[model samples]
Target chain A: MNWYRKLSIKQKQVVWAWTFLALPVLFYVVIRFYPTFGSVLLSFQDWNLLGSKTWIGLENYEKLVADPVFWKVFNNTFIYLLLGTPVSLLISFIIAYHLDKVSFLHATIRAMYFIPFMTSAVAMAWLWRWFYQPVPVGLFNNFLASIGISQLPFLKSTFSALPSVLAPAIWAGLGFQIIIFMAGLRAIPQSYYEAAQIDGVGPWTVLREITIPLLKPTLVFLVVFSSIGFLRIFDQVFNMTTNDPGGPLNSTKPLVLMIYDTAFNAFDMGYAAAQTVVLFTILLLVSLLQLYVMRERT
Target chain B: MKSWKKTIIGATAGAVMALSAGFAQAVEIEYWQYFYEARVTAIDTLIEKFEAENPDITVKHTTFPYADYRTKVAAAIPSGQGPDVVQLFYGWLNDYVEAKLITPLPTDAFPPAMIEKEFFPMVQAMKKDGAYMALPTAVRSLALFYNTRLFEEAGIDGPPKTLDELVEIAKKLTKKDAAGNITQVGITTGMNAQDHHWWREVLTRQFGGDPYKDDYKTVNYNDEAGAAALKWYSELETLHEVTQAGFMDEGQAAFKAGRAGMHIDGSFRIGALKSTRGLKWGVAELPAGPDGMKSNYSSYWVNGITSKATGEKKAAALKFLAFVTSDEAMQIWLDTVGELPAKPSAALTDANKADPVFGPFINGLGYAKTTIFANESGQRQVIMDAMQRILLEDQSPADAVAVAAEAEQKILNEYYK
Candidate 1:
């Protein structure tokens, strides 16, 4: 008890700071940091979930580099990011811009758009899959057939599968992005828009000169956020094309799904860890690249 | 009044003591399975009976979704928290054996001679390292399920007997609108997953090629015959225009909805198919290949004790397993789940064989082959992809098979190594 009173004020402050940080620091070490290091170490080893782990010294990585499926999944993960981010951002921004001016049932309309984001990804994937089925069973095909148009294969054809999967993914993410955009729009001073109106400036000109410039922060944040979301996409692709996951011929397969299949289905933990390390590197690089690209001009 | 109070106190103490004693003496063993309505109900009833019979032991039941079951088991068993007794697909036997996750049955309890005499030939799947690692209550084999009304409407007199006849009948049965959209499908094949299973287990055999060789260590389906089978399976979609890969939610949905004429499925689906309102369906033996070679698949889900269980828990699990695979449980499974009994004596009885809906599957027991593929799901995906390349990407079947064989061979090579 007497030892407690012997500490200096600076020491006491240090002790308190560490005491407050201790729980989170311990948590990060145990839950987050431990697994990260373990996976990195495992990347260089060979272990099937059941057997003893062996030190293969980069053999798993060599295999990954040589694997054709890994390359396809790598290309797919990027396509998801490149296509999903810009398309969804444009859509949500457009919806939020128009929705901000509407007075009637504003909350209801906003809630309707946001509901999909809150809904289960598995359910959403299955629903979208149902909509993509052939003529007699699928909604899209039936509607097309009724309108005297040819039934287009949404999920069956390899050329159409990646984009078809991207549509549902983009839809599922719009609600949160729209809410952020709306908040950004709301924060902009109304007087700027009023002045622009008094000067006889049109909506498009005001949007271009003032709104877009002011909303750049929100835009940049969402672009990075949505890009990561798309890059790590698994549930939609897994659930929709579950009969043969990763899409037909792996057209819709992403990196994370490949990691899951490798780890769980194949039980190749070391190989799976290597793939996960690769995914982690890609995510880090992409996020950093986006942040650098969107840095302030001044 | 004092006497009455003493009596009540004494009785309360005794009751509390009895309850605690019961809790202390009871042993609990958990049983795990994938979610299936009929399978669950049948097992629940059997578990109730088991608990009643063995007063000192309690059994807890757990079920995960079908797609996640194997993964959950693989993760759980290694963590020391898996179920004491587990129901696993027979295809996983090799993986489990290699991983040392499950123990072989004691010979005293399940003697090899007894097993050979009692169970069907597929029981060979349970033997690893010259001992039985698992035992099953029910077994299933794929059979041809055709919509009777659809066949009659299409002017087909009988189910096709050969692969070429199937193509002809499927072409006749397919119904298309003026816009060239298929309204009714003849069969479910092409890139669909079921197509791959049928191809690997049935068509590959018919085409005189095997999926794997040398104790499942070599990929044997990369040759001309494999290419011919894959090409034939895809012809249902491309050549005949009968059904495309995306025709229904899957093959079974098409048959249930009366939109498909012929579907290849296991006897496990009979209970559900029988209840489909206003649908007239009939089961036939799977058609032979071009060479008139007959082959079919027998897939079984067996219950085995995990290696994590030991001592008293292991003993209790064995008792549970014995009860589950006994004649009574087999009868219960046959009556309720619409699956063939794994026990040869139980299944080959005249009364059971006379059953029209289940008869074909039971008869298939004679020739059905149970594949010991280590990762059935992964291998299925490989074949499905090969089919997709042929149908959607216009890849030649020979090239597609070569590619699939290369990928599948990689998996086998790793396993064997």
Candidate 2:
């Protein structure tokens, strides 16, 4: 107590600031940083879930490099990020742009879009899986058959399976992206659009010159966010192909699903950790690259 | 009269005190299994009986969804937090053993000679390092489940006895629409389902090819006979056109919806099928191959004591394990779960052999084989991929089998090495 009374005001404020900051710092160190480093360490070891871990430096990474399935999974993850981020961004922006002009039943319409985002991923995936089944059982196939069109093997064919899985994933994320885009549109000053209208500029010019430029920050955030989401996709693919997860020659499998299979089904924890490290690295580089490209350039 | 009343009150008090003491000293053991309705009910009943018998021990039964069950066990066992006695698929024994997740049952409680004499020969798959790691209450074998109404409508008086006859009857039973789409398939086909097991254990063997070369440590099903079997199986969809893959989404679903004339499934399907109103179904042995060879695939879920169990917990777990595999429990399991008892003594009674629905499955036990899988999920994926390659990629059956053998061999080598 005597020592505290002798302390300077600056030192006392520093102590108070640290007292508040300590918990979260401790949390990030223990919960986040510890496992991050531990997984990196584990990548150089050999362990089943139950047995003792033995140091087998670089073997897991070597095996991963030589593995054909790993390469396929790596390719699938990139496809999801590249395809899912752009397509979803464009669709959601189009919806939000047009939707902002409408006034009747606006909240209800927004709610409808948001409902899918709120629904359980497992349930949505299952519902989509049912829709992809053959005629007499599937909704899409039945509709196609009724229209005298041949059945499309949406999920059964190896070539189309990955894109088919991606469709629903994109659709499910559309609502969230649309809401974010709408908020960005709302944040733009009315004066700029009013001035553009006064100048008698076309809607296309206004959209290109004013709306999109103003929405760039929202676009950047969503691009990075959805890219990470698509890269780490698991539940949708896992549930959609429950009987043969990532089936049709592993076409629809993503990196996280492979990590899950290695960790649990194969009980190869060290190898799974190695895969996790790879995924972490990919996420980091992808985010960093996106930030650099999308950074404000004024 | 006063002294007699005092004595009676004193005796009552003493008994109450003893009962409370017993409750205080009770050792609780946890049991874990995948959630299946009938299995959960059966295990619940067994737990109640076991608890009643031993007042000093309580058994806690926990179940996870079938999809998450393996993940739960894998995550929980290493932390010494999950189950004392856990139920695992028979095919997972090698994995469980390699991981040291389960301890072998005590020989004094379960002697080797007695197990060999009483249990079916296939239960020997649970043995490792001179001890039995697990014991099963019920066993399952695949059999033909034919819709009787469809059979009668097609004018087939009985099930086929040979492979050729099966295809002929299936063609006759098929119904098609004007658009050339099949409305009712003669048989259901999906390698993603039980067909993988059917192919590896039954069809391959019937066609004179052994699936494995050395106690399931080597992949040996890439031969001419294996290709021949693969051709026959794939031709059912590509050539015969009596059945199609992905019809009505799943084979069992199609059969349950009465759109499939015949389905091949384990005896476990019996309980569910029996409850479907207005559906007439009959069970039969799987048809023999061209050489009159017969084979069937048998599998089971076995209960084993986890390695974490020791001293008091071990004693309680062993007692619970023994109780579940006893004759009474086997009877209860068979009645509730529609699976055959693990032991011939409990399963091969006159009453069970005479039952129309269960008889064929029981008879299949005589020729049943359990494939010792090195990596069950990985190997299943390989076969499924091979089938898809033939059906979708237009690859030859011979090539598909060769590729599958290589992939499966890789899995085997990874596990065994």
Best by TM-score: 2
For model 2, residues A1-298, the per-residue Cα lDDT tens digits are: 8987888999999888999999999999999999999999998998876678899999999999999999999999999898999999999999999899999999999989999999999999999999998777889988888888888999988888999999999999999999999999999999999999999999999999999999989999999999999999998999888777887788999999999898877778899999999999999999999999999976
Cα TM-score per model: 0.94, 0.95
Q: Each model's interface RMSD (Å)?
A: 1.7, 1.8
- Candidate 1 residue spans exceeding 4 A from truth: A1-23, A194-205, B1-12, B190-192
True contacts kept of each: 0.74, 0.62
Give the top-scoring candidate (lDDT): 2
Candidate 2 residue spans exceeding 4 A from truth: A1-17, B1-20, B98-100
User: How do the residues B334-399 of candidate 2 rate in per-residue lDDT, one tens digit apiece?
Assistant: 898899999999899999999898889999998998888766888888999999899888999999
List per-candidate RMSD values in Å.
Answer: 2.5, 3.6
